[model samples]
Target: MKGRTIVLDHIDDREAAALMVDGKLEDFLIVGDAPAPGTIYRARADRPVKGQGGMFLTTPDGPAFLRQVKGLSPGALMLVQVSGYAEPGKALPVTDRVLFKSRFAIVTPDAPGLNISRSIRDEDERDRLLEIAHECMDGSSYGLILRSSCAGEDAGEIAEDINAMLAHADQVINDPETEPELLLEGDGPHVLAWRDWTDPAEVVTQAGGFDTHGVLDALDVARGVSEPLPGGGHLYIQPTRALIAVDVNTGADTSLAAGTKANFACAKALARALRVRGLGGQITVDLAPMPKKDRRGFESALRAALKADPIETTMAGWTPLGHFELQRKRARIPLSEVLK
Candidate 1:
C-alpha cells in the first residue's frame, strides 16, 4: 500500500483526461476516442516502404507501422499490438508481439518465455519468481513476464492471474470469428500511473472540478525550466530536438557536502520528473563539478535512482565533458505534445 496516488480528472472542453501521480501531472489521455497502447488489431500488411525497414499495415486505427515485419508480405493479414499512441501526423507503431498485462504479470502470445523485471534486484526473490513462473506456465506456449508489482504477491494468486490471462489471449488469438478490430484498449495515462504504483487503491478519480495547478507545474518543467532541488541546489531540465539536457547547479555559497547532496537529489528528482512528464529518448545530466575521485560514487547513486524507472533505460557512461549520458525508450508521446 506504500505508493503514490493517481488522480484522473476530466478536462473541460477537451477530449482527454489529465492524469496525475501524487499531485504531479503525468500526461493527458484521450477519453473514449484514441486507440490505447496494447490494443490488438488484425491488420493487413500494405506495400513496404523503402528505407523505413518496416511495412505499413492497415489496422482498425488506420495505417500503422510494423517495426519488425519478418515473414509478412503485402496484403497478408496478422494480429498486431499497438505499441504506442498515434501522434499527430504519424502512424501508430504496431508490433507482431502482443502482450497482455495485469497488475503482476504480462502474457505475450507470440513470444513464449519467462522473464523477470529488472527492477527486481534481490537474487533470491528473482529465483523464487522464476520458479513460480515456470510452475504457472505449466507447459503453456505463452510468454509470462513477472512485473515488479509481483514482489510480495502470493504464488497462488500470481499463478491464477497468469493462467487466466494466457487463456484469454489464446482464445482471442485462435478465434476465427475475431475480425480486424480492437481487442482491447491500451492503458491510458492514469492506468499507466496506477500500474507503476505499488497499490491500486491509492488512486483517486474525480469526474468533475479538475485542478489545473498541477498541469501548469508539469508544463513548466516539460518546457526545460529549472526547479529547486533538495539541499539548496537547482536542476535545469531542457528537452531539445535530439535529447533531454539537465543541468545541476549549486549556489556559490553552498558547502561541498551540500552541493554533493544536491547533485544526488537532482539525480533522483530527474528520474521521477522524466517518468511524470513522459520524457523519453536520450538524456544528459550535467552535474556541478565534482572531484575526479568522486565520479564513481556519483554514477552509482545516479544508476540506483534510475533503476526505479519502469521504462528501459541504459547508462552510457559519462561524456567527455563529465556529463552523464542515458537513453530511455519512447513508450508514449512526449509531455509537450500531450499538453498541447
Candidate 2:
C-alpha cells in the first residue's frame, strides 16, 4: 500500500490500486474503485438512430450491474435500459452492456404504454420529483424504477418511474462534452436504507447531501394518521442479523411510561416498524402474545393502547405459535428486498 491516490472524472480500468498510511486512510485514498458497472455509459454505440427522436441503446457491460441485483440465489434481477430508440422502432439484438438477470432473453425493449408528467408550480418547492424528472429525462421519454418495485407495486407508479428513467437517459444523451455515465444507480434496498447519524435538521436543508427526503415524506403523509411525534428525522438505520434493525430511541422524551407502558410500548414499536420497514399498502402484524397472566386484560389493554395512532390498523387474530397476526398495508420496501 505505497502508491499515491488518483481521483478522476471517471475510472478507466476495472481494477485500480491505492495506499494506506499511519493506520489512517486519507480522503483521497478512501475513494477506492469499487466501481458499479452499467449504471453509467462511457461510449455512444456504433448503431444508428432509427426514429423521430434520435435514440441509442446501451447495454450492461460488466457483471457488477447484474451482481448488484443478484440475490443469495444464482439468479439476479435484470434491469434493461433502452435509450435513444423510441417506441414503434424495430427490435434489435441485445447489446453486451445490457446485463440480463438470468440470461439475455429475459430483458426486452419496447415503448411504454402510459404517459406521466410532473411539474413544480410553487416557489418554495421541497418536493422536486418534477425537477428530478426533468434532470432525468434530458428531454425524451424513458422509464425506469428502483429495485423497490419488486414489492408488489401497481402499474401507475411503475409507469411514472419508467418515464423518469427515460428522463435520466435523456440527460446522459444530451451531454457530449462530458463523459456520460450513470449518475445515480439504485442501490440494494437494504443497503440504501442504512441510517445516517447526523444532525437531522441540517441534513434536511443541505444543498447537496444524502437526504432521506423520500422516506421522510412518506412518514409525514402517514403522520398523525399513523402516529404522533412525526419521525424526529434523526434516524439510526443500519443492517443487522435480522431484517433492517430500526431502533427508535427518543432524545428529549425520557418518560418511563414511553418505555414501560404495554400499549405505549407496542404502539411506538409498531409505528417505528411501519415507517422503517416501509410497509405500505397493507401489512400483517403479529404481536408477541400479551403476557399470559392477564389474557383478556392484556388484549383489552393493547386495543385501548393503540387507539391514539391514526393509520387504519387492526388486530386480526393470534396464531398457535403464540404470535398475534394482523394485516397491514404492504409498503414497497417491505416487498422489494428480494435479496434476503
Candidate 3:
C-alpha cells in the first residue's frame, strides 16, 4: 500500500489566524470577528404568536426575510437575538438577556427560514434583532464556534465569555459615554483551538516574542525561552486534518529471515509506532504472509501484542492479496509529526 496525501481548501480567513492542533492538514474557523468572539443571542419569548393577530406570525415571508438577511446565506448559523420582556405596551429595555439553547445551532437550509416565533412590539428592537440574525447568517456575528475545545466547558464559563463579548460590543457602540479611542477587538478561544487542531507540530515562538506569556498562559503550559531556530514561526503538535493513511512495510532481509519471525517483527514495530505517535483512523498493513505452518500462531501473537497499546486497533482478516486491514482510533495528529 502507498501513503495517502490529504488535501484541504476553501478556508475562511478567520480560520487561518487560529492556532493549529494538528500540523498536517486539519482546517477550522471561528464563526465571527476577532477580539470579542463567540456571542450567544436569545429572544424574550420562545413563541410570540397570538391568535387573531391577522399577521403571518409563524415566520416571515421567504422573499422578504431573504432580502432582510441578504448578507446571510441559506445554511449559515442563526443565534436568535435575545432581550428582556416588558409588560404589555411597555417600553423595551436598552440591554438584553441571553439564555443558552445548547450553545450554538447549525443554521439549516429552509425556504421561509427557521421560525424564530419571538416577537417584539417596538420596531427598533425588532430591527436590532433582525440585524443580529443577519449577521449570524452572513458568518459575521461574534466569533463563536461549537468545537471539541468546549467539550468539558461548564455553562458559567461559556456564559462569562459570551457576556464579555456583548458588553464589549455594547461599549463600542456607546463610546460617546466612555470616550473610546482604540476599539476593543479579539477573537474567541475557538480561533486558537482551530489553529491548534490544524498544526501537527508543537507551536514554537522565539524569545521576546509578542504575547508569549499570554499564549502559553491560555494553553496552561509552562513558558520557557529556548534558543531561536533559523526560521521564526509558531510550533504545534497536531495535524490540520483528521484523516490519515499509513502503509506498513517489511524490509527485504527481514522477509529472508524466518517468515514468521518477520511478520511478527513488522506487527510489533507497527504497534509500537501507533502507540507512541498516537496514530488514528483506518490503518491498512500490507504484508508478506508467514509460511503456511506459521500463519495462525503469528496472527494470535500479533493481536496479543497490540492489546496494551494506547490506541484501539482491530485486525480484519487478511485479504486474498495478503493485505491486512486495521481500524485504529482517530488521532489528533499523524505519527510522522509526533515522532518528529
Model number with the top lDDT: 1
lDDT of 2 by residue, 254-291 (tens): 45433223333444445444533334332333332235
Residue-level error in angstroms, candidate 3, position 330: 1.0
Worst 10 residues of 2 by lDDT: 99-108
Tens-digit per-residue lDDT, 232-310, candidate 1: 7888878887788888888653676765676778777777667656667789988887777877787788788877666
Native-to-model Cα distance after best TM-score fit, residue 41 in candidate 3, in Å: 18
lDDT values for all models:
0.72, 0.31, 0.35
TM-scores across all candidates? 0.75, 0.26, 0.29
Off by over 4 Å in 3: 1-257, 335-340
Question: Candidate 1 — what's its lDDT?
Answer: 0.72
Model 2: runs farther than 4 Å from truth?
1-111, 115-167, 171-184, 187-318, 324-340
- Report the number of backbone clashes for model 1: 1
Report the poorest 10 consecutive residues by lDDT, candidate 1. Answer: 25-34
RMSD of each: 4.7, 17.5, 19.6
